[model samples]
Target: MQSLMRVVRSASALWPFYLAVVLFSSVVAGLGMAAPFIIREATDTIVDTVSYGTPAPTRTIVFLALALFAAEAASAVFSNVSGYLGDVMVARIRQILSTRYYAKLLALPQRYFDNQITGTIIARLDRSIANVTQFIQSFANSFLPMLLQVAAVLAVTTYYYWPLTILLLLLFPLYTWLTALTSRRWQKLERRKNAEIDAANGRFAEVIGQVKVTKSYVAEVRELDSFGTHYGETVALTRPQSRWWHSMDSVRGTAMTAIFLGIYLILFLRTLHGHLTIGEMVMLLQMVTMTRQPVHMMSWIVDSAQRAVAGSRDYFRVMDETVEPTANRELVAAIETTGAPELTVIQHSPLDAREPVIGFEHVTFEYSPGEPVLRDVTFRAREGEKIALVGESGGGKSTVVNLLLGLYPVEQGRLTVCGRDVADLGVEDLRASTGVVFQDSTLFSGTIRDNIAYGKPDATDEEIIEVAQRANAHDFILKFKDGYDTVIGERGVRLSGGQRQRIAVARAMLKDAPILVLDEATSALDTKAERAVQAGLDELMKNRTTIMIAHRLSTIADVDTIITLRDGRIDEVGSPAELASSGGIYSELLRLTASSSAADRARLKAFGFRVRDDEAKDS
Candidate 1:
């Protein structure tokens, strides 16, 4: 009940529309009450005329018929108008809820997404919003008017005959108590059902996204069986749940039938004994019948309310989560105040050449307790220096990037970007000052031009073309026959791996931030393409503070400093030449690369590695 009320309170902005709906519904209810009395009057008049053996009062009968018709017609018209208002209010509430949900998602930390499935998150939003909206509409159009009608019926029935009113009053409490008994168990089952559905939807999305992997393994039947098992479990739960609900409903139904039967018997006996007029008995019966409709609908309202309560609980669970702090206020204000917000980029004061562009001091971090991904790690990148991080998989290379961008909070030691503590800096400011090219080359389904200029949405065609040329993507883009306008499909699926990587590189280049982080930025490219893009990157790195991760040892040879990681601790940090002779992780990797196959050596040579004649011949 509290959760249901919270759903209503959340839409307080639409209260005026709700007010209108209630007012219109009140008119419909009042008119509905008039019909019973009008029928009773006409019935008594016809009986009197026949008993007296008088001429038929045709005009009087016609007048009463027209009054009845007018009342019914007005009731229908008002009911429709109220329904329309209810629909409008539901739409507005849906918009408000959906916008809030989306905004909350955007403000949540990266770790929240790490443990949640994309499809499950989406399913919860869709289902919760849908149920809440349905309930709101039902309450406005059916529930409110039902209550009003019941109250009017009770008042009218009590005025004419208190016995029938007593029976009607007793029925409500008994019916409600039985429903309450079943609801607790029914709601529990509904929650279980929702969990299963959410999981199934999550898996469905995962399968569709990775259909290629499933097909390669020929595990279609396996996936289908797994998917069906979730729904099957829900069905298993539903059997007993349905039985319990219907069993209680049957009991409530019997109770109602017995009470109404007694009320009818009393009405008939009273009319026969002259304690009541025929007209009075008829009016009371009509009013009691009117109450029956609401009584029958009570069960449906309870069922719907239960579903709504469950959904609202789910909705508020997300709403109650702590959101990350607001983005850079100054930047936001500038954008808000500017006439051309797209053209405005917040500029910070320049740092001295001697100051570190990035600094980490004994930083230790973990995604889970007692399982650190980075342990007491320290590193520094000075302004205008190109630093490279080289390590095996799961050595916290990506975590370092994630922390620097403020995707995850730094928990143990001090980390600073541009001399400002990362914890003190707004995530938007930290990210706005840095450009990143991730390993996956994530791209949206859009034109080549759109993807390239994604980082700088206001980028001109000439600027986009320049970066594309630097990334060695211009020639391939033109060959698509649409130049830059060709749609690349989702995540650049239509493009080759190398082509996608180049576009990603161009995006980062277009961002033109002071600091650049590249996580295997050129890993997908061929030897020739890598060399060309590497040259372009080298030129771009001249006056920028660049940090990169490279598995290919040859690629980092030209960097000013190399930070080698082994088991999350910095194994060595020195210039490339110094590390080559340090006999550490970097030196070991160099030896292994030097002794690799001919094709590997040739690839290394393309990145300006010195391949010895003996080592080349051995390969």
Candidate 2:
């Protein structure tokens, strides 16, 4: 209830419209009560005229009919205006909620995203918010107006017969209690139904995202069978949901009928005893029949209310999540000191002259308690240096890069970027100093130019073209009829692996940040493609501190320094020649790659490492 009220209060900016709705609803309620009263008056006039053997009060009938028509006409105009204003109010509410929800998504920690799949997060955010909107609409169109109508009806009816009003007042609580009890069960079912629906959406999104793989393997029938099973579960749950809904409707209808009959019987008895006039009896009967409609509508109203409450709880759960640690005092101090735009590159020198451009000092970290992914790790990248981190999978190469990016806060020792403690620098400021390219690059659904210019949103056409040429993307981009304007489907699916990498490199190059990180950037491409994309990467790496992570040792052979990691610890650190002479972990890894390729074997021979076929073929 409080959540619903909070949503309502958020639209306080549109209070003028809300006030109009309330005023118009009151008028409609007044007009609704007038019709029954007018009928009672007409009936009384006719009864009196007949009893006295006098002429009918035709003038009085005509006047009452005119007043009823006038009331209805006025009510119609006000109701129309109220409905229009209600729509405007709800639209504004949706806009406010959507903006806040999206901002919250941006502020949330990356760990939150890592724990949830893209489809699941999208499903929950979209569905939960939609539920809130539906509730708001339902409340405006049905719930509030019905309450007003009920109050008006009761006030007029009670004025005519105080004793019967007392009886109704006694029964109203019973009706409310029954509806609340039934609605409690429905609320549980509603939550279950929403969960099933979100799960189905998540699965559908995941499968469709990999449709090419599914088709390649000829798993169409198998996928359909899996989806059909999920559909069956949804329908099964819906059946029980529908059953409960009907049960509530049944109870409401039967109870309403019984109450109406009891009210009528008492009214009929009182009329016989002359305690109630014939006209009063007729008015009470009409009002009792009118009460049935709102009473029937009550079941639906309660159900909507329950579903809204459940959804609001879920929506606010995400909204209430603690944001990333970038909200700390050190970040605030960094922001205040620079006074630079969030995305603007800072050119200031290091706080400490001895500190490297990027450094990790005894950094120990873990995603969960007591299961460290990195331990006693220390490394440095001097300005304009090209460093390579070569390691087996899960050897913490990416974690080190992630720490430098400030995606997660350091729980152990200190990490510095651009000679500033990452914990003390604003996240956007940290990001502003670096550009990155990953193995699986992400491109939004937009034109080629849009993807390339994403980092530098205000880049001129000439600048975009220059960077694209530097990254080797301009020539291929022009092959499409629309050139840079050509729409790249979601995640640049229209482009090949090499083409996507080039575009990603172009984007990073355009940013022109002083630090660059390339994480397995060419690992996904074929040899021909890798050679083509690597040229672009080389251009982007020039005059910047480059941090490269790759399983392919050949890719980093020319790097200034090579750091080999084993079991989350730095096992060896040296130049390619130095590590090769030492015959350490880096040397062994190079030999492993050389054993599989003639070209790599030739390169290894120059480094004085031999790959014996007997050793490679050993059981």
Candidate 3:
């Protein structure tokens, strides 16, 4: 009900159209009632003339028939106009809702998405829009017009048959009672069916997304059985719901027909007794039929309202979500007060544009209260320095990158980039100053050119070619007959792991931000692919403040500094050689790598690490 009211309030802009539809419907209804009156007059005129031993004139009968036709013709035209206007009003409301809903979805915080299934979210949104539309349409085309018709019929009937008007008033309560009872049960069925469908869709989408994993684990038969179970549950719920809906419709339809017949029988008996004329009986029958329509529509209108209310609650829940602080005036003002350069641009500046490009000063954060993900994490990287963060899986490696990107809020202390506090920087400004390549590279469904141009929408062809060349993606891009124009399937499924990583590097290169975050960038690839991608990474890292988060220590062997994290705290930070020689956390990790294989030992030796030959031999 609250959702329905919200939808109505949102559609207040179309009040003028509503007014016009109401007026048109009233006019149509009035004209429609005129037909019965014309028939009443024609019948009386013919009967009176013939009963008095005089023949009824052909012209009089023809004139009455033409009058009835004119009334019907006017009614039809106005009804169509009313219907057209009502449709326009509904469409305008839908357009308004769609725009606001989509904007809300985009502005919502990442956590909202993380906690929801993509398919279920989509289905809920679709149903919300449909519910609002159905309710508005039902009210306009069915309920409101039916009310007007009822009022018009009562006004006319009360003048000639006052007792009949009283009876109609009394019967309304009985009809309302019946509709209420049926609608309650029907609404329950509808709500259950909706939940079943959403659950089924969410499960189905989850399964489809993990199809590769299922195949790898040889769980195809299990997955098929799971899907079948979900389908069966949905079918089981839907069958009963549908049966209830049809049964309620049948009850309403049967009651209405029986009531109308009873009313007709009473009127027929009245005419036979000479208490009512043949013409009056015809007029009364027409009014009863008009009244019956609204009475019959009551059940359907209430049912639609119930469905709408159920879906709307979930929809508005999303619209009311709290969004991340994309840009805050107070935060910006605080940063400006520090006398640092204002971070106004939403794109990367040249290499000499800023210094102390990325830093964390005793910063702390957590996803849940009382559970810190990072604590006292202080680090800084000057312009053109390549800093690497290496740690176990649960360590605060990814958390650091997330903070730098402002995906999560900084709860304590400060993080700075380009001499401005990152906590105070607008998300757009902070991200524009940095480019990121994640472990799982995600490419949208679009052409290769489109994906590359995503970060730099207006990038020129020459600029794209230059970056692609730097990232080592140009050759493979050319191998495709469509070249840059080649269409990549969802997440670039058409491209190999190496090709996708290179394209991601090219995308980052195109952004050309002063700060680069490479999070497990090449950790998933084979040696050959990693070598190819690393070469591109080298080109991209030049003259930029690079932050590399990797599990593979070999990847960051030559970085200017290495930071080792342990239990959400920085355990060691120094030049790669200095940390490896100190026999600290970094040294122990290096020893573990040194013992993995002779190849690792040789790689450590190549990186100038002092790995004893015995360490390699023992393992």
Highest TM-score model number: 1
Residue-by-residue lDDT tens digits, candidate 2, 532-564: 899999899988899998746657878999987
Q: Where is model 1 more than 4 Å wrong at Cα? A: 326-354, 524-542, 596-619
TM-score for candidate 1, residues paired by index = 0.90
Please give, for residues 1-619, the per-residue lDDT of candidate 1 as tens digits: 8987776677676778979998999999999988888888888888888888888888888998999999999999999999999998888888777766776677777888999999899989999999888988998988888788889988877887887789999989999999989998999999999999999999998898878899999999999999999999999999998999889989999999999999999999989998877777887888888888888888888888888888899988987776666444543332222121223454543333336789999999999999999999998888888999877677788889988888889999999888888787777767877888776888999899999988677789999999898877888888998889999998899987778878887887887778888878776666766676676677566678999988565567679999988778898999998988899877766765656677765545443334444533443
What lDDT does the true structure give each of the candidates?
0.82, 0.77, 0.78
Best prediction by lDDT = 1
| TM of each candidate vs. truth | 0.90, 0.89, 0.87
Sort by lDDT, best first: 1, 3, 2
Model 3 residue 469 CA deviation (Å) reads 1.1
Pairs of colliding residues, candidate 2: none
Residue 444 in candidate 3, Cα distance off native in Å: 1.2
